[model samples]
Target: MSPRSASVNEELRRRSRERLLQATVELVGERGYEATTLADVADRAGAARGLVSYYFPGKRQLVQSAVHRLMHLTLAAALDREPRTDDGDERLARAIDAVLGLTRTHTTVMRTHMALILQHEGFIQCPEQQKLAALLEDTIARWGAADPGQDYRLLRALLMGAVVALLLPGAPMPLSSLRAELFQRYGLAWESGCPPNDEPPPRS
Candidate 1:
């Protein structure tokens, strides 16, 4: 067989790495972070055990990247879904719902991700995280922010706070309440984005 071209080799490597990340997400979501190991992720991805270490220093980093990839992919799909528009309000609303939706749909993954990020290590600073940040910055820019960078930070903080609230142990708040607070902060209508219910939750 002929030797693979440089581009082909790179593409193969990318696919391998992607599989590992995906496997991490699935295993972690199904079994929680501690229960899932690097060997298990590699086995699930059908890649070599050493490849996991080559792509990620450890299981925590791997899981973090996987979750970040999930976040960016979910946000991208929501923003580009059918009937897509350039309207700032709609785009911002979609972004908010997309992130918030993860808490409900992937509770284990999101909770683990949030806990890791809050630890001393902070963000993993991987490419997946960069992509997620870029998407959020674009959303803020579309939403008429004079300073997209600053506004993106604020939006990120708000979203993180909401996720923490929704995932809080023993005293978790209602998703609708958190969503309503976010919509109110951005001056969005209750009907915007994918509202969980018809009427907004009553406020005190």
Candidate 2:
């Protein structure tokens, strides 16, 4: 080949970055945050170690972006799954379930992500995070919010709080309870989205 076009180069770089992010998620989930290192992530991604540094300043930022990507993908899948519709209530319900489900499905990665976010560096503000934010903001707008931006912030805070509650060491709250509270807050029916079980969570 004479030369790789700019578009081809950009696409290659995107794939490389995505591999690193996926590797970070897998390694962190398997080995926990402390045990997982940049080299380890690079090896898992089958890319050079320097590539990780080129894409992220440090391990923490890498992990955060990975988890954000995971969240965005999960939420997108839920929203776009079979039988999809534009019903605001259903979409909001799906969004809540999507984030809450991560605490259970990707426990280790999500826990590590939450911890990183609380540290001095705060959120990474990367493309992955922006994509996730955009998805949630769209969901809120579909839910008939007067101000989707403000509502997205509130929803994000609530989801973070709920994740903390679910992952609180030795004192984790019941997922059903958290789900119930969120559904009630958003005026969603108990049966909407992916309900953990039937019978409306047993009203307290």
Candidate 3:
């Protein structure tokens, strides 16, 4: 058989990286942050252990990138959900709900991710994070922000605060409340974007 072409090799490399990222998400979600190791991620990914080191500088960076990828995929899905609308209000609502939803469903993974970000490492400007930023910035622009650049930072700050509230240990806040606050800030209707049931998110 002929040797693999450059494009084929690139595709294979991409797949390996993606597999490792996905595996990290799954393992960390299952076993918590401290318990899950890069070796475990490699095993779950069915890739060589060394491949994890190649794709990520360390386990910390690996988990962060994995979570970012998960967030990007999730926000993308929400944006593309059926009955998609061009209305900025609707799109922004979906974007907010999509991220807040992750805090609820992927609580463990997200909690670990948020905690890591708080440490000295801070935000790692990986490809996955850049994708997330682009989606949010575009969403803010669509919402008719006076300045997307400024609004994007503001929206990001709000969402980060909401996630921290949702994941706070022993005293977690309600997602509904966070969602309501975001909707109010964005001038969105209560019924928009994967709205919660009749019961509202409790106020602190």
Candidate 4:
């Protein structure tokens, strides 16, 4: 093939891949990962199933790509909305707020992430999962000033657990109260005051 033709082909392939990723995101968000099939993704993307396979090899790869893209976009938006400050407590607060805000706005994405975590076979294998873990580790290390290995691991686990609990169905605690509890547990400084909640105050 001529150089010009090869360049055009590469551009086309990139566009197709982007379309596939977008479709995957939409489908996963709407239907959850296990429910979304390659055919559904192809139909949504207006591309052939073969094309998705050509780019991603399998459904797992497609889901991984979509998750990675979603995380990057969401994390960037969260960071932009609440940029990190010099204070460690502020950084932790922002991080907690970011995660909660993301979950509140993008419930489907959070649900998909939870579904992924339950699957032992795919959870650890996906590149997006590794990237998320690394991001969590890096964020904790920066804010906590602790070793990134075990300490960050434990912190990440705690944060994720708190997130899951907040997302649980029919949880008695309100989100605002949950956010405050997280900040306090992590030793974050509250600028204004405790979050608005109907619950009674703790005994002095």
Candidate 5:
């Protein structure tokens, strides 16, 4: 193929992949992973079932792609608004706050992610999960280094468990309050504690 034609073909492939990922996200978010099928995703994306199969061989692959896409979107949002600080503790605190905001802003995505991660053995085995876990472990390591007594792995578990708990049906606490409490419990200052107008401004 000519270089221009090859470029166009690659672009088309990229767009098709993005559409498939988008459909996976929407259907999985609405129906949960177990209830969503490749056929459903193909219908939602207006693509042939064969196209989805061509891109992702199985339901597990589609769900894994969806989860990875969701995580990327969530983390991108959080990182865009992340606070700048040199101190390890301060950076960790800001990260916690950012993650909480992400969870609140993307509740459906978060729920879908958690549901997939916990209930689907395939998801647990996916490479994307390993990448996410490593990122999280690195974040916790930064905080744990600041406080030698803190267990990084344990802290990660607590934060993940806390998100799940807060998302539970009939949970008593409001998201905002729960967020604040979680940060404070980890010895981080709440945004409310900042001086008037001194809170880190939102990112553009």
Candidate 6:
């Protein structure tokens, strides 16, 4: 049989890497960081144990990349979810909801991811992270930022802060409250973007 083409080989590699990343997310999120080992992730991915280190420097790095990929995919889906729109306000609202919604559903995973980012090795620079950043930047631009470049940074910081706040242990704030503040800040109507099934925040 002829050797596989270069493109085919590249596609295989991409699939392998994606499987590893996804396995990391599932294992780490379900089992927490320390409990989940590289071997476990490899096994879960049905990949060779050696392939783990070949794809990622360590479990921490692997988990970070995986979580970032999750974040990117989550946000993307929210932006294009049912009842989609191109309106700047609605898009921005969707972006906010997408992220804040994660705080509710993926609390444990995101808490661990944030802790690693804040207290440990700092931001892991990977293509997945860059993609997440680019999408957020685009969200800010779509929101009609007068200076999207600057506003993107601000938006990122705010989202990070909100996540940290939402995940704060023993004193975690309410997602509804955080959503209220974000909506108010961006002049977004409370009814926007698959709004929660709770009462609307009171008007000033």
Top TM-score: which candidate number?
Answer: 2
- Give a tens-digit lDDT track for model 4, residues 1-204: 999999999999878887888898888778877799999999999999898878777776677677666765655455445344545555556656666665666677666665566664545454555766676666667676657778666766765676677677677346666666666677765552223344453322
Residue clash pairs of candidate 1: none
Best by lDDT: 2
Regions of candidate 1 where Cα sits further than 4 Å from its true position:
1-4, 198-204
Candidate no. 2 TM-score: 0.96
Q: Residues 63-89, candidate 3: write the lDDT tens digits.
A: 999999999999999999999788999
lDDT of 5 at 44: 92
Model 5 CA RMSD to the hidden true structure, in angstroms = 6.2
How many clashes would you count in candidate 4? Answer: 0
Model 5: per-residue Cα lDDT over 17-135, one tens digit each: 88888898788667777788888988898889899989777876677776666564554444345354445455556555555554555667667666766876635445455655555
lDDT of 1 by residue, 1-204 (tens): 345687788899999999999998899889999999999998999999999999888877898999999999999999999898999999999999999999989999999999999984888999999999999999999999999999999999999999999999999988888888888888888777888865465574
Q: Over the full model, what C-alpha lDDT does candidate 3 score relative to the true structure? A: 0.91
What's the lDDT for residue 47 in model 3? Answer: 88
Regions more than 4 Å wrong, model 5: 1-16, 31-35, 54-57, 82-87, 144-152, 192-204
Candidate 5 least-lDDT 10 residues: 192-201
Clashes of each: 0, 0, 1, 0, 0, 0
- Lowest summed-lDDT stretch of 10 residues in model 2? 195-204
Model 1 residue 52 lDDT score: 94
Q: In model 3, which range of ten residues has the least summed lDDT?
A: 195-204
| CA lDDT, candidate 2, residue 15 | 99
